[model samples]
Target: MIDYNYVLRNHILTHNQIGNASDKSNTQRCDVCGTFLSSAYALKAHLQLHSDNSKPYTCTLCDRRYSSVHSLRMHEQLHTGEKPFKCEICGKDFSLRATYKTHMFLHSGERPHKCVLCGKRFKLSSSLKMHIRTHTGEKPHNCDTCGKGFSTLGNLRRHQRIHTGEKPYKCTECGREFNQSNSLKAHMHIHTGENLPKYDISVIIYSLS
Candidate 1:
């Protein structure tokens, strides 16, 4: 007589053990990119970036090469100085349509990206992703020069100006320069006598009361 139930129980236990072992092994993460993969095959695919010989897509103008064709196309835009996508509202242009679409959100105030945890809305998915980091306390962007960490890449880029001493924004009025545009605008207010937009607050107060 065959003990079918006992045989099935053993088989299930063995399968669970194998799954647990596989999960534990998956904890081995890539040191270079910090990517975690479940299997050896996936890990090997990710580690291809560490290999210098595997960059198949090479840029003709620059020494930069990528493993994917899509990345190569994006890099080639810098060499060609191509601005194919144009905005209908502001007449501004972008090299990629995705960039132009994101820019359109600024004029439309159309915040489509919403946070799943906090119910907060953002104009862009990148903004939503950065907002999520506030809850997680994850500062992934780090400066190699100072070992300082920032929550967003924009903040990190601004911080790098301190090390590089780069003042990119300039005021046309006084020929004053600043590392950021907001600083230049604030300085401009000194000359322009606070060009703040006038608004009637009494109507809003009466409605609220």
Candidate 2:
């Protein structure tokens, strides 16, 4: 099972980022479900790959469609019940592979994506692209309303809410609304009356299953 909260956080942090630049990748693959997205901007619309809304991939076995092919495959697993990620080398499937894949990068010491401007090394070409922007002062993401610039598309959308007065996030308990997700999370404390507990993301994912 996917820890949706963890996925949400990752989406909030990395949704503006595209595929690793040096890798010549186009997809912002979901870290949770391995769904390939052509654009980083589409992450929110997919709802962490678990939402019922806007599902385009349909299962021929049933009426259910899903936001991603990965999701559709997982759902079809309910009928057939097989699963998981195959290691590229040995071809053994694992329940989880994100950290394992990163570990391989470390084992090889292969951070191929380097910034030409600063000699900074990154495992992801996306990170390298973002780093390069710091030197070039490029703001590819711009606000249509105010003509303001942001380094990332996520930041641009977040800023746009100020102009539009739109609040998409709401407290489930109090029904109070907020323009940002972080604000909604912080407001949730009023109902719980405690600080959120710190749990390893793996622990949360384990509980979800």
Candidate 3:
């Protein structure tokens, strides 16, 4: 029911009366500490697809409903694709400040968040939280249909695609579709010929001779 693709598209404005990201009051950055917030927020919004409870805030342009005004303001950025945060090391642009800060750790080689159980390190605390679930056997998210459990809300949503049959990832070259982004990436190598293995058969034939 939620036309996610429609809401995400770049909309052309007819007039300059509408506000842009330049206005801090209109579009402020999301909280950096809410690592799982986007996923949890999306899952809750997805629930609204089956319920009568409308989201508190809706996009002025797209009319896509969101739980909060902060979320609504954040969604407005998608219309213009304006990334305020930029990485100095890699010259990469990010929509969220938290993601930009986390990316800096990759260049700095600083794994501040470490798993207390297995001693594995992570750049993001949310990743460490999900990793800890592996040792504790804690799967907080569950499927309503099959009752299958997943540690993170993201994994649960991806699994729900099995029931929903939603294949969002598409191959531009072959027109093939996949349920997951990684699957689409793997499929792309077939067109780019990146995954093929090279063998020096001439050397083997000469050596045998």
Against the reference, the lDDT scores of all candidates come to 0.71, 0.65, 0.66
State the local distance difference test value for candidate 2. 0.65
Model 3, residue 135: displacement in angstroms? Answer: 0.5
For 1-209, candidate 2 gives per-residue lDDT tens digits of 98875664455444334433333454556666555554766755554457556677889998887778887766776677454665576565544344356546655878987755457899876777677667655566769898887887888999999899999997788687777776666566667777655645543343233
Off by over 4 Å in 3: 1-103, 196-209
> What is candidate 1's lDDT per residue for 1-209, written digit by digit as tens?
99875675444333222212235655547778765555566668778878877988889887798878988897788779899889988899898767888999899989998765567899888887788777655566789999887888899999999899899988788776777666665566667886633334542232223
TM-score of 1: 0.53
- How far does residue 29 in candidate 1 sit from its true spot (Å)? 4.5
Q: Estimated TM-score per prediction?
A: 0.53, 0.41, 0.47
By lDDT, the better pick of 1 and 2 is 1
